[model samples]
Target: MNDIGGSDTIKPAAEAGRVTLPEQGLWKNLGQADGLESAAQAWTPLMFGQLDCAEAVCVFLVDPEGGRLRATSHWPRTRMPAGALIGAAEAAMENNRGVVRGGVGDGGQLTGGLVSVATPLVVDGIVLGAVGAEILPQDQTDLRVEMRRLQWGAAWMRDVLRRDASMADKRRYSNAIEALNSVVNVAEQKDIATATRSATTALATRFDCDRVTIGFQRFFRTRVSAISHSAQFNKQMNLVRLLGAAMDEAIDQRGVVIWPETQSDDPRATHRHQKLAQAQAVGHIMTTPLYSRGHFIGAVTFERPTDQPFSQDEIEILEAVSTVLAPVLDEKRRNDRWLLSKLGESLGGHFIRLAGPGYLGRKALLVCVAALTAFFWFTMGEDRIAADAVVEGAVQRTIAASADGFIAESFARAGDVVSKDAVLVRLDDRELTLERLRLLTELQRGQIEYDRALAARDRAETQVRRSQIDQIEAQINLIDKQIERTELVSPYEGIITSGDLSQSIGAAVARGEALLTVTPIDAYRVTLRVDERRIADVVEGQTGTLVVTSLPDTSFPFAVRKITPVAEYADGATSFRVEAELTDGFDNILPGMEGVGKIDVTEARLIAIWTRPMVDWMRLWAWRWLSLD
Candidate 1:
């Protein structure tokens, strides 16, 4: 028998031969009733109603599995008994797809009416099944129609199967996404590397790889930890270097790299990895970069036992697993640094205590305390001197305009302690009033002339009435302007300290000028300047007892009002301006009385004073240099 499998007689090229064009010679060769069973049902009625033809038919199914072939459907079989197995089915499964003239009945009987053609059923890369149709010799034209119908039926089946396969792949991808989410959500406790290794190992087992590794990239080197399945496996360092080098290309370019069958003959791929692969019997290699927070953190690699390239689905799984490992690795690295620092601290403490001089350290401590005390006394207690400072009422002034025009207006001069809004000047409106009156008189004169020019008509009388109305309006305008400029007020209200205008009249004042300067008459603040070297020992909110020279030995309570950051260059020294407010201003105290102010900057243990200055000087010098402005 002629066959195509395992033989030199049927060449691969001969089996690859393509089908002839169907619209011409083969188009008319297929019978209408000789198509697939479903096609036969559709075309049989058309043939019987239109063409008046009825005939026997045969259809064969060609299966790729086991290269088996079988009779799928037959016409007149129920009445005439099952038809014998035909050689046409075997011929159709082979040689891609072709038409052949063959006899039926187990290779015994003559069945020349059979016109068999095989149509391949393929979806993606998988071959499903093929269809073969046989027809009667008398209905040659009808047989051609049947063959064409079978051709279209084969193509339709291929499309339906392909859609189903694509949908299945999508569902698989969705499941992978969910699995990745679950892995990422797991809590990351201490020992991040072990946690990552545990996760990577579990994933590698699921994907059926020889080994799985997790690593992070730092500069030119990649630090890797190999988490193998068997306990006998030790960490292999050389493998880490090679994997890091190989991954740099993919990571820098943001792409994927696949190396197939690298067990031997590749110098770029590490021999150490090859040995491990040999031990584990792996054949394929896939490395994927791990990305987090829009940066490439590291990579994860898998080793397989077969040379088959990883499918896109498998690569997606690796990427998803890498996402889960990224955070765990970063946490582990941070924890490692913390552990080393603690170890260093423990050792340094012991070394310093065992190797230093004893007496010198104690004497140094005592001197430091004394120096600190002196500094506090000079800076913070600078206002607390032996001489006394008195509590006196603040000085104030009130000014009013000397001349009277219209007394235009006032902006809260009386009882108003304004900082800058005191108004003591105004404008005059008498001249404006005179102008309005003059204009009104002119209007009346014009009215009188018009009235004389016309007596019978009352038009001139209307003009005279209009002029009188204008005179009244002018009077109202004069009153408004006089009222607007009628008042000249005091600048500020401080018990009218300087300007007591209730008893004075016609006090001429300038057009625009300051009337008074009002200071608070109840409370008072004493300001003193302290040397810069002593400023730090002073602080805000410090309290001190105050004595007034005017009151002899009597003392009053006081507090630090403020310590200005600005330094004043005065009296051959740099000093900070300090202000202190007393609890009460003296009832009979006067301004400009000479007094002294003092404060206590510190009260510290004696030992701290001696070293404080040197410590402060070193601190300032170090800060100036190291902080670099």
Candidate 2:
């Protein structure tokens, strides 16, 4: 054979190649074909003539009804193209691009050495078919040129494919609109059974299916609601069960499930689908999940004869119909229910969402709330009353000035610790000293007069002088006692809780004036300002704990010693003074330290403990406003 790439070769310059008279006649023949199959047969030979050294050629086109690729025409009319050429065409269609394969043998020998090139015919972003050719081995440039010619030759084929696709789309759209109209009519039915039955029957007739069944998910199980062509059927029937199982299978996968699945489809669990098909002796079956408000609510299953399997276009149309029908059907089902049933179902759906897995954060929060409610409802806790508390000395003493004088000195002040007999305050004693000296001089003079009268033998005069001397002596003793009482001192080891005489040194003070106040150390009492609303719960001998602001980390245990019967009003609230002595001694505690206290009254539920105040207030207000008759 002469080298196909030599000068004898026909090289068409343009991408589509110049159409000679013979080519024009061939194009006319291609146009005359009634369908894509006949046109492919006429076009294959023309394409083969445009390229050099072509051993065999084939044209493949997709079957719109079946959504499958088949060889429409091939060269060498006696036999089919090589398996390698067919594989290249399938691959190009699958990949929606051009594919090339070269054959080579060992030792650089040309063993059946041929190059195959396949180019997919795509139009409007859709792969419609592929054209493949086998030729003798050629250089890379020549191979590229051949591929370009093959692509250009597919242009007419693209136009034909586009037209078919547009027609199919229009038909599909019309069918979808018709299906939607039927669904709208179904929705008009007031009862769920009627609507579901109408929907199934309409789908069966529209798709030319032998039977159609609709199932709704209830209690985590699929229940067949309606079957096509049957006004009434036994739910216990084996056929109904099988149909429900198929629907459940599709629903569980949350996708479309088809028996006799295509090779291009994703692998799925179809054990139930397979069983259903085999048991019913059905040739084909398809089930698609139904969603309402973006939730999987049910499924629809279609059964057809063995001769006609569901095509891609039909499956898409079914999906669209189901999407539009789900919510409508669901609404009908809802309206047909009893009032109580509607509520139960509405709550049931929410409960299912709460109980199921997913939404971890929301579930956890719900669990916490439930647990807290249960704890407060069923568990008992200490029924304690909370109140503002203050630390006070158990026994307090006030030191008053015993004599009129000035505050001379202060040894200790408020918050200071002092031992017994500690000099706390002093007053001015200069005037007392002067009075004592003058009285002593007058007593001495009276003694001298009495001695002079006795020497002159005057008894009456002596008696009078003796009386004046006694009176002067008494005055001197009184002055001396007043001077000694000027100094103030603590009667016991305690803290100076109130007086601060250190700033008033030398200040004049009247007798019996309060110079300082002292409280014994290591003895403290907690005074709780219990709200009047809760004072009824307070009683002597009740135990409680106190936490002072200054010593927050430390808690002092105390028992109520006294509950003042009178209520004191202050700060827009009324409270009763409740005195409690610390049962547990603490050295760090000081008088006047403030804190909060909780008084344990009795055991009660935590809910009651927290809501008691509010409840009491409400009760009181109601009693005041609604006490008539």
Candidate 3:
């Protein structure tokens, strides 16, 4: 028994006496095409002749696929009935082990024992088949040694099968490589027209096809370019139409279409291939799509007779060829004519094509886009002027130090909301206190002097003392006022947007220096940092929406209140500040919270609304250059 596949037949090899290898003298009259019958007969006798004390021997050889088995030849002329030999070999194959069984009762020349022993012959783990023989308990008690002999014989048979399989693979790959080289050679053609002709002819000749047609996408339909072996052909011919339709079907599906696809269940395939083949009186048809950048650009159809249907391998090779062909063909098509001519042809041919058959879906989309553009451009869209706006207070008030003094205490910081008369900061008033005391002492001394002058009745002394007292009183009052103003207070109900007095603690501030800024909460404004380019479109009474980073999903409507004439540098670009008032207030909006705002200057076309920014940019750029020159 011998096998050549991965199936249960027998266990590992065992020790045995060295037997004569098949390459030495066995298989002397063998041939591959005869299914190894002659080799089996030639080798079996040699294997049996080496075994000692065996009553009878019969070899069962299994096919490489493990699907069939045959009794090659029996040794000792008549070992046992043919049925008994086959049954024994089959049992070993099924059980994947050596077995002992009673003979089928038509025995010949097997008087050693009542039972038959079948040992599986396996090579490379492939359960080939088993060798059956009649042996007694004393004839061959060592079963392992007998099984080893069978394996030694099977090794030679496995080699023959492997070599046979390799040769066929080698030939198939060789042909595949040659076909690839032909495709490469065809792609090297300089001109598209010539390339098409050469490629079709080369493909037809190499693949042994009755005919081959190459076609490319013309607008939305396949236009035949070249037909194998035909220099001149009618475009309106029925056969040409059928070929074009078949090519179109393949290209549209982005896959190969094979006629009589009796062996496929692909959902993309159609029976149109069969229809075309039958109409053309061809046995088989195969249409392979050519793609460039994933778009189906063209296809090539092959026709053959019934006896020579295209194999899967041939179709696969053609698919690879199509990949190499598409880009080169596309480039050739582009260079075949002038660019201006192609552009002009495209312009004039568009309307004609739009009204033609096919691409109804794409045409519908084109119509929709055009209509949407017209509606936005001409039907009156909201003319909104978009700008980057910094949220600010409409009326901001500043708290300043009254005199030159060191900050003693900071009662408020930026972002701290406070009411009117809220103490924002306190200044050191020790100097003012000393000044007031000195002035009070002077006033007391002046009063005493006045009393003395009055008691003496000296007119000149009285006048001088009265003037001194008035001067002292004025100085004391001024000191008291300064002390009161040292505690800087907010002038309005608002948030402290700037001037954190905590940073100014113990720091000397001059008279009238701002301590902190407080902007009123009721009056909110968005200072839009609009690009200088679009400043003209921004007027004083427009309205738009605003969205800030903090509250992006919500929109607050605002009306343009003022457009600043000054330009400021922001984010490395020159922009103008346009102030707007919030018409409808929303939460999370606070002064100094920057956001984006759009002002509806007027209604404009959708195209204009979108393109105005670009137009304005171009105008400014041109103006800048013209002025520079």
Candidate 4:
């Protein structure tokens, strides 16, 4: 006997009670029963469950329509050969009892089992299916008890099969209704392809199909997107492009399209088309609508490779998913629109701020203030009036050389303050001295001659001798006068301000050439120019103060001496020359030193401050207009 768990064969029949039947056992017709007509139709899980048994159990049912055996269920102890059960069922139905089998083989290895039993399933007096049971030694059991149990199970399975067969018609009717509802929901919610895809994917997965696709009308074009598929389908493969025209027509008409097999379609359909059945072997299709705002966005589709089709519950769930997905798609569109609007507003607002009135107004105000300040400061500040001024100088005698001769010596040069008789320049007087000596000798001789002639007193001779003596005295006097004119000298006590030619040792000087100039150093004055407009304000004896650039802060006081009637033109500025002599207190005063003297034009009120610049400007304009050069 084989081990209980490890055995590849069925348990021994001797382990349970066994009953022998006669060579011929009676058969019952199941098709003849009432309500059995509708039960024999399609495959059902209850039939499959009963067929699962040890040692090559076989079950054949009427397929829930009573027309033919729609499916056969089998489980074999050892590996069952492919198609063996189906072929055995067809063969054993000819006799329709339990047929014992022999070892089946082509030549060497045995292919048949130790025992075989054939049973036929009948419903409504019609043959529906047949079952063949093959047994090994380990599978022998109490045939009477097991066979009785199988009969009871088959009765129960008939009810289950009846129920399963009716479900398909109900499911198909309900699915059509659900697809219509999904279309209505999508139309009401105004969602497009997104809703379609979501509904189709969920529905396809629930039904376990090879694929689901959502096809839609895109203008004259048809578009398709896959939503869900069985794991057997290639994830990354692209679909054939021959279905676009059919889908397009179906979607535009708002109707369902079914492609039972894709290979029937033309091979060269243009634009986003698919080949239905051939390569990818899509076996079935069901599609529904997608709508936006009552207008079509697309459709939802489902597919399968084998015999399975979508159930009612799956379609109802998809309708619900479509209803939910519609709003989500609308919300996504709304968010995108809102974001674009916000961006446009932000950019427009920035431009408005840049060109707005506030910016221009502030800029204009700044420019106005700047111009006003500039005009008020530089031009107005420079138009000012200074105090009246006076300057004075003393006139002095000019001394000159009396003769043309070499300067043999000198007694003075520049800056030497001198007295009335100071010798300033000396020409060569040697000849004059010698001539003077000769004149002196001649004068002495003439004097002796005059005295001798006076002493002799010869009355007649006295007259002639007196005439001779007078002539000799006249010659001596002429020599003395010539000697005096050769000496160049200063005529008064003054500071040397002009000539100083003490180095003319052998050079000649002309008669009346000024060898040096001497002005009084201790007798100085200040001179000033009064603008013509302000000259009327000046008085003859107004006290003036002088300041020199060399000693900038110092002031020398002097009384106004005289206002010269002459108007001096100084670099196109016309002013009346006013002179003021220094007081007796300045012993060190000097002439020809540059200074500005201020004469009191008398104190005036603040009104004068305003009028002063105006008065000066009027004078300037008048002078310029008159071409006063």
lDDT of 2 by residue, 478-507 (tens): 888888777777889999889887788888
Clashes of each: 50, 2, 13, 39
TM-score of each: 0.28, 0.39, 0.39, 0.33
Which is superior by lDDT, 1 or 2?
Answer: 2
lDDT per residue (tens digit) for residues 277-329 in model 3:
77878898888888886578889898899899887667777776777778778
Which has the higher lDDT value, candidate number 1 or candidate number 3?
A: 3
RMSD per prediction, one decimal? Answer: 34.6, 43.3, 38.2, 63.1
Give the worst 10-residue stretch by lDDT in candidate 4.
20-29
Worst 10 residues of 1 by lDDT: 1-10
Q: What is the lDDT of residue 436 in candidate 1?
A: 63
Error of 3 at 158 (Å): 99
Please tell me which predicted candidate would have the highest lDDT against the true structure.
2
After superposition, candidate 2 runs with Cα above 4 Å error = 1-377, 450-467
